[model samples]
Target: MRWMKQYGRGDNFCGYYRLLHETFRIESNIERFREEFENLYPCNNSGKIGDITESYFVWEEEGDDTSELIYSVYQNNRILYKTVDPLRLLPFLEWHLNNTTLAKLDNYLQVHAGVIAKNGKGIILPASTEGGKTTLIIGLMMRGFKYLSDEVALIDPRTHNIFSFPKNLCLKEGAFNLFDPLRIGIQSKEYYVRSSKGRVCFINPERITPNAIGCPCEVAFLIFPHYNPSNPLELKKISKSEAVLNMAKRLLNLPYFQGEWLDILVELAKKAECYNISVNNLPDTVELISHLVEER
Candidate 1:
């Protein structure tokens, strides 16, 4: 691991390593690797670095003229990934960083969802991976919804208020063409091929709305978004019991609550208006949600 220090040029440091909710150091041997992620995550020097520091070493194989790069990502002195594809490295690094940060956080009950706020009221859209959470989040942001997060919703169980995570929104290739028409500037962004999600691009939330990250707000709506090409857009109000059950499937930190997780979730559901949204077209779905938020 000490050999990694000697591989890179003098100016290969990455300064933009602080997440909104957590601080972690990232060291990389390649300057481009540092630059790419720095563009996604702008620097914040406020918080102290936690226990999860990640280091990435990327270099070309000696005497190989094919320009193939080898990369190894280490988290806390242990190897988390070793691979050859340059396009795959950033996604893996980002994924590991988010997971490690979420695991280390003890204050908030994290849920697998995209969160946004309008007029200081939070909306939680819970869904599984590749379920169009990020895509819908981008639409809402464009329509003046303040961005909280595209992945995890951090809620204070005692208060039922959702806080800001505000990580870069990662969108799949299937969404590339859909968003290009909105003039949100995705065509110029570089795309990376992920093994699980196919081609993906990372969009900094600041690009969509500068200084528009929402503050901690009481949960106003809990909408479970399901994207279906065959179905038209539909938004239906759901019971609190049903919302609690659906939310349990997406809750990431249930074990942290011991046997009280259910009570916590029930209280959360009771505080927010719940709905099941069938998503087909992006603009229509966004409009529907906007109307719901405004009417409530």
Candidate 2:
């Protein structure tokens, strides 16, 4: 049996890659993507251009300074997740194919892919950054829902699709506090610490969904998480068009979602239920969504 592995371990894993629909082409391995530049190809910096996605960054560290490196979406000649570890890098590389990233180098992929599942009955929680998407998903996995990508809840361009890239959930800084009761392990040194949101590897055996399979995700609810607000957890319906726009906003890879692709995705939003979940509090936020999930 000829065996080949990408990023290490599991060449036959291509089946899962296909099922997860994580397939794309590498646009190029050039020095620089943007023309207004020089010494571009062998870059060691990170930042965002353009008026809208005008994000800022610095060459935090050299890839040579890290342990193992993997450039998932090496596009527009930008350096993302120049990690000192491969495991930390591989997930994104695996999820966002070279083709997908190339399509939306400047555009980001958006979706609250936290514990998103049909769960016998279609119930979705459209959560986002700082809304405890990971926290909520980890909690649900404890109850018996399948795991999707903790961060990138990949939406398939065809099935109007949402996919599952089940793996270890990302724990950002203080976010680890919530899992105290569960006592998830944190592997230090491996994570590429960030100023605002550093990474942590957390997986609760109790929360690990047996085989960790993917589910055809359906967002029955859109919970616009509001952490630490002086407000109660309220639910409201979101319009389909509005939902599609929001999903696009949440996409880490947005640029590629253009033309006919955008049309298909927009239609998807029109087909499902959307809700705004106001979560100013963690316990309150978790409880509110738990109740909503149970109700569905």
**Per-candidate TM-score against the hidden true structure:** 0.87, 0.56
**What is the Å distance of residue 246 in model 2 from its true position?**
1.8
Q: What does candidate 2's lDDT look like per residue over 90-175, in tens digits?
A: 33443334234334422323454454563633344555566777766666665565666566555556565555545456566566
lDDT of 1 at 271: 82
Q: How close is candidate 2 to the true structure, as a TM-score?
A: 0.56
The local distance difference test score of model 1 is 0.79
Ten consecutive residues with minimal summed lDDT in candidate 2? 33-42
* Consecutive 10-residue window with the lowest summed lDDT within model 1: 1-10
Cα misplacement distance, residue 185 of candidate 1 (Å): 8.4
Q: Give the TM-score of candidate 1.
A: 0.87
lDDT of 1 by residue, 145-211 (tens): 9999999999887887899887788988878877764443235647776789887888888777777
lDDT of each: 0.79, 0.48
Candidate 2 global lDDT:
0.48
In candidate 1, how many Å is residue 96 off?
1.2
